[model samples]
Target: MASAPHSPLPVQLTTARPTVDGDHTGTHLGRAARRGELVRLHRGIYTDAERWSDAPPWERSTIATVAAAHRSPPPVFCRESALLLHGVSLLEPPRDVTVRTRRSPEAGVRRPAATFRRDVPPPHPLRHHEAPLPAGMSRPERRDALIRGDRGLEQTVLPPDAVPWCPGPEEGLRVEPLPLALLDTIPRMSRPAAVAALDSVARGSRLVDGPVGEEDLLAWDGFLRTKKARRRWESCWAFADADAESVGESVSRVLMDQWGLEPPQLQVRFVVDVDGGSRVRVDFHWPERGIVGEFDGLAKYQKPELLAGRRPEDVVVEEKLREDALRRLGLRVVRWVWADLRHPTRLRDMLLAVGVPFRG
Candidate 1:
């Protein structure tokens, strides 16, 4: 009666063992492709049509990147390509694939959907250098000279242990390790996006709905030394909350920080007397100001999994009631949707209108 929902999981051509090893006359493979039973991800990459159709843009790009990396004499997938492989979301996807090549490509050499760059290795801590002597060269001047001379060697290198191996039916694909990958990625992203990526990587326990343990905190802190931008990393880590439940919420928090607003308590639970007693969790709460903020993402109402057997209408009704119950306790409830996030100034103004104060 109705078509099946598309699956988000990626399907590799290697998984199509029958078609991969079966025919060469363009008979079976062509039929499958024509029938929409298979979708080509790249030149030699294919996935189940339904799965490819269902995946989001980022997911498809990620799959394609993986496929490209598996080609003969595999290119070192780096930068945004590596970020995708490591499961970090980007504010914007790269227009062309990025990879590390052994040497710089011929001048003006370009692929329609791929870009290449030469790799830089970590700088040696101690290296001899010669620089033109300035009259009365002070210690600071000498130090600057050394830094400039050793700049090339100061580049961070991916640790041998940190490379990620993505297994597929054909074999496995190698990617930069999470820590080094973040180093390359963070420098290319805005502060807020970088913070979100760091939070995601350090979020193993949160994914399981467990407490954010010291091990998780220490691991994230330790990884900071593997790259440059220690101060930026520290700023990101300082604002990071393993408790942030979604990307939108994480971005909202970063925006608040950028706007100099007081940080809201995340996912705070409230015990309501309504219906004899009920517990409700809000996305953000400013306890001192008696305010609660909710990021009304569409998925909460529209996604079947999130709806928990309830209709969209039922979710709307339930939320209205929850807001009313919250309001009854002298708490002001405010809500913003994805649209507000796009125009963040409007979101900030809305919160301020409700008496949310700036951080002093």
Candidate 2:
């Protein structure tokens, strides 16, 4: 499998003299911010306003992580932050930008006793946080940390004897190793999110060269730290399918399981005798029920690679004709979109309406 192309890191500027973008004084930065030409990501850290506005939530979070690295001593990114740096797919953007530090919590600073847990409900889609700055830092530094923390940056102490992190996508930054990051993150994700992330990890991403085999996943089991975390890892890994080609399909599978629907085969292919015996792969299939499931993500129509230079209307027509061919094969087809996934009961009702049976 070829690696996906990586997006260029957003251009960032700082108050430091002779910075990456250029030398800029505090006064100049302040003026830019006031003029709405630059968006402040952290104290003294700014990026082009247009780029900030154009980035997706996940990319925006990644940009913020880069901003955090500008502090006196950067933190080692972990959990979703590390996954984002690794180019792994996330079901939703992180609620907070998490980093691991060797610094101890200073006096009066409170930290979550357990930052990662499976039982807690997933965070709302929008990002928010209230992380406090560590005590003992300079006043300006403390204020900078506090401001970013309010915008969802968190710092956790690194565990004793922790594994070393790998070099990050950017210079001078480090992230937890992919396997360790997966173990630390997946246990805390919602079931669907966890499975989707694991599927992406197993299938590989930009930073990862190829599929992460079962051996690699098992290798990290010893790092799981606790019995509960181990169990959560097991439960999640059991449902992870590398055949899930996209986050949408992965989430749909989890929804099927949650609604007590029988498991369906993923990426099932059918040989159509059209266009010289072309093979068509469906997102999901239940041969026992003669049903095919498609998760209709807008990317299919919007992404240039998927569109293959064809117009959106043409893609829609091709999809309709493909559905007709499947119908000709006597397969009941069901389709749902991101909206259906957001409304928990909507997808379940759609599948049930199509006679997708519950698990016995």
Candidate 3:
């Protein structure tokens, strides 16, 4: 007789659970409650030791997801769980799972110190993603089984004013994303932080045009609840003597403002009736000082009919063409790379040497 096909190795914990069907259960254990081929996790949870490696890292979190889905006392997956489900790059490393029960919070002490929460998700615009799974795999499986529940969470995007709380230095919690992870990690970031994050994105070969909708900015603007409205509106689209605004431009402005330097006029246009009637948009300009602070982000130098498919040297020439245009206008450009802002003090000094006064 042929043997039954074996389950994929549980890269995390061994389990009888089928990889996709989500089922694995034992009817009863005889007196003395003996078991076999055990792989212990925290407690009460175990992996069928036979096949452990096939499971991936996410599998470990599977226990939380399953427990969350089938709580006898329903749980809301709030706080850290809520943040995790929402894909917030910054979140607390989860320990004891939390839940809000429709019934009552689980009585008796659970080994992992479970916490009770109100059974509901927070408000909206903070989007949540719900996923369904098979029943039998709910609680019996270990971390490997945790991977079964799709990120079952519903959340509104965090409110802009929520000041993202994440792991920090000297703290032993699990770190979430690297200091600079996803390009949009700063979607709801505070102004100062957004400045830092945008600088990180700008340095990479990655920025695309800003997402057209102003919903996130609009939300943040309303929620700031301080004199920041003026600063935000001003910084939202900072003028560099005569340049249009992008996050890079805004960040450039913030650096100047925070450091007490002269802010440039934004999107100030200078027109010349060229041979074929061509028009142009510049990034930032300081007319009196004949200076322009240009952010050479991907857009300015990576267009398709231009550098996108060309050799990198060709890309350098494309940048030179733009620099030449500003030079023709008698503007002295102060170019800031992503590194300049990492040390704001030095950046302020650099500008000061070129005639701006930074009180710093």
Candidate 4:
């Protein structure tokens, strides 16, 4: 007389297809679907709506791309989709999905949500006889490989001097190489965001250590045909600093650069005699102006790893002590958080109020 045990939450949409067979009954899935517990991502794929809603836009895009890749003739993850797979940051995730296919580019399949492009052979797909992979390949290339070894895709020849990506052992999805992904991504981003993305890759975060250098990017820029794209991008690239410690810092630097503010020395160290000659590192310092800037990401206190076994209040107290020490040294401290970064006008005003001059 007991009701059937409720169906367990399905696996992440990227890994499994929700269907009404093979341990997944129509009755159970249908019940969940009707109850608003499951949302259909693509044909045959269903994921928890709550989880999908909570995931970052990039993660959601990835799930959708993986689901669409499972179609009869899978599409090559290209353009934005390819960039998502490469873990590159975007200004904003696109609502309209893009995929490349060899299926004659059907207009019928083109919908408000999805766009399919016809994969054509490049006029001159790069082939370096001496290079193991390609001219700008950071790693080796696989001639015929499955994305995650499950989904099948038709490999398209890359354009002349195109960069190629190699697969990682555990990365769940196949993606274009870092350089190619950047090439596709830069044009789509705003000037500042594009610089942020480029800075992120060049700096080599824990997630991705891009192999492309500034000079390499310059060479690649010559291959792009978009109007004024290379000129503007070069400016951003030139402004990019691998020294930025976080995305917030990187973006803030861009804003400062755009406003024509004098560049502050990054990650400067000061030996404060307070608390027995303790040394401290400041995010941005202008010795001539006697100003120090701090980008206060809450993670410093909230994240257990960053806290390093110290209590949140303890970290706050330590920061206060550090600030007081800096003040004693005749330096003015200006602090900003994520919210301040969003209201850049207000931020600029605050900095100007603190006597941080901008170049006219």
Candidate 5:
């Protein structure tokens, strides 16, 4: 999957003539959308279809968030939306563009009041309409502002009693503070995703030499106003490890735990005899089992900095030699990729096949 671009492409509003070629009148814009030449991100908002198609889910969410922010009284982004703005890694793209509002849910309101426009099919179904709306919003006010196209985009307003805010990574965008965002976010995430987000924050803050420290947890714990929230926070925090070098590693660790496999030491280093006794760090190491596990994210082979002037094939060969050296040291090496994570049973079988021991 492609990493997010340094900057998002410009969004176009139908109220003004778009800078691109061809007639940019409202009718023409609608025609362009029907022809799949343009993608509608929100009502009156548009971007190039090709670019939108090429963007990964997280980037797409970011683009949609930007589109929504173009409106007046910009929403204070939170949850996954805030995480994306904060540059935190997520296991999956969020289901909607989430914002925070101080408005309370109506006494009788049990379901979301947002309505959808089905004139154009979205790239994927967005469940923004499923999120509850604040009390006092009229039927029209509850209606989503986005014109569904290729992929639907909708904003979910979280009606907490008091919504806090901070400056977003991008100027003019308001977001929840990182701790508050994580507290709101992790509870709703799957174990792998929750750990990935926490690991990311721990890595970024560098507040401690290892996993998030007691002080950090206490600071975050203070933000919890409810026992339920505190329990959720503690549950996710238990899996966090700062040593997880990447999202893949973080996710792999969480899955291993969930599968009841023996936990592996992360980023274990060895002074191999190869290449003048160079030191190499492996992703996961089980000392008792003599096993090394690697999560092969495409970034290692595709990112320019990671390649470091070496071709992808050369990197593969180097990895093979590294594995050979580890084998010589009587260690069994096992590897998995992004796809394997999606199939838990397959990953579990792979580990078992390689004699990865389960927890006692």
Candidate 6:
């Protein structure tokens, strides 16, 4: 109901068998789809009428496909096949199914609506998936079986030895380890996908219930810092002390506190001269002194690529213009740079000289 019941435990390799049961008529299936009772994913893969109350079925199936591959190994789903199996996020959603596997199956194996990819392991195969299955071939044996007829137990990953990386549900067709999944996906996955995975397992909430091992998650922080690709996620870094709603604001808040200035109400808004229809949103506000501190970052005045395209003179001129405008409205404006945050105490003294008391 919530998720396609975890692939029936001990499920068999269904490659040579019918994916869907032979029970009811196609008409009943058609009616359900028409009534939105059964949402058809791809073709024969159908999910309950009601999707996961939250995420789409694709995400659920990503888990399921991986399960299927595990239930029946010797055909490690990979590449596009692997992508299809894991529900890896793609821009236009891939048409050709990809997978990474050392060997290819029969020559003319045909899929109903998707093309199966045959991948040779890259030096670093994305072989991060693995899990041990129950030791049996019973009614639900198919859920964790490897070969046809549920013959033997073959691990799912192409190189089963590289089990530390893959994320799956269990030992046999099990879900990959959530942390390893996050790490494996970080370099290759889009920010949203990678972020989603990280958010799912790495959130403060999950950490509470997690069985934390001796491994230090923060060790990866240094590597993430040097990425230079997208630093916005740094907001979640263990050292990022601010709780700004967005990463930019988070960085700004961290700097403000580091500088020892009394923290300001973020996104502060106050109406200005009514007739002038003036209004301002201060990045930080010294409410007691009516002094506003704005943290300037490239995203606002300059695009990320150009870093600081504004001339130093232009920056000074703009700051002056803004200061004048705020002063006209009876508000004093102060600015902070990225460097100031490194020595927030110095900035704090400056604020104190300007009549803003420091609790220090």
Residue-wise C-alpha lDDT for candidate 1, range 159-254, written one tens digit per residue: 222222323323344554445555545755787677766666556432212233445345434434434556776677677777776667778888
For candidate 5, lDDT tens digit of each residue in 118-184? 4332532222222222234443444443222322222333222111121122335665556666766
Cα deviation in Å at residue 119, candidate 4? 38
Per-model TM values vs. the true structure: 0.68, 0.75, 0.40, 0.70, 0.72, 0.32
Specify the poorest-scoring 10-residue window by lDDT in model 3.
120-129
In candidate 5, which residue pairs get closer than 3 Å at backbone N, Cα or C atoms, i.e. clash?
A: 122-150, 122-151, 123-150, 123-151
Over the stretch 1-360, how does candidate 4's per-residue lDDT look in tens digits?
001111122335422434655564535655565566665555445556566555544445545555555544444555566665555544455454566432232312333211121221111111111111223332223222222343333233323111112221132344455555566557666776777666666666523434467564554453345556556666676777777766677777888887889889899999897778889999998788999999887767765667888999999999999999999999999998878877899778878888887765
TM-score for candidate 5: 0.72
Task: Give Cα-based local distance difference scores for all models.
Answer: 0.59, 0.66, 0.39, 0.57, 0.64, 0.40
lDDT of 2 by residue, 1-360 (tens): 011223434355454444566655766876776676776555556666676666655556556665555544555667777777666878876656676543234222222222122322222121222222232445456556555664333323333212112112233555566777787778877888899888887677534434566676675555566678779888998888889988888888888888889999989999765566678999989899999999888777776777888999999998998888888889999998888888969889889999899999
What is the TM-score ranking, best to worst? 2, 5, 4, 1, 3, 6
Least well predicted 10-residue stretch by lDDT in candidate 1:
119-128
Task: Give the total clashing residue pairs for model 6.
Answer: 46
- The residue ranges of model 5 lying beyond 4 angstroms of the native Cα positions read 1-36, 104-171, 205-226
In model 6, the runs with Cα more than 4 Å from the true position are 1-252, 255-261, 273-275, 304-319
**Model 3 root-mean-square deviation:** 16.5
List candidate 3 stretches off by more than 4 Å: 1-190, 194-246, 269-279, 298-306, 357-360
| Model 2 pairs in collision | none
lDDT of 4: 0.57
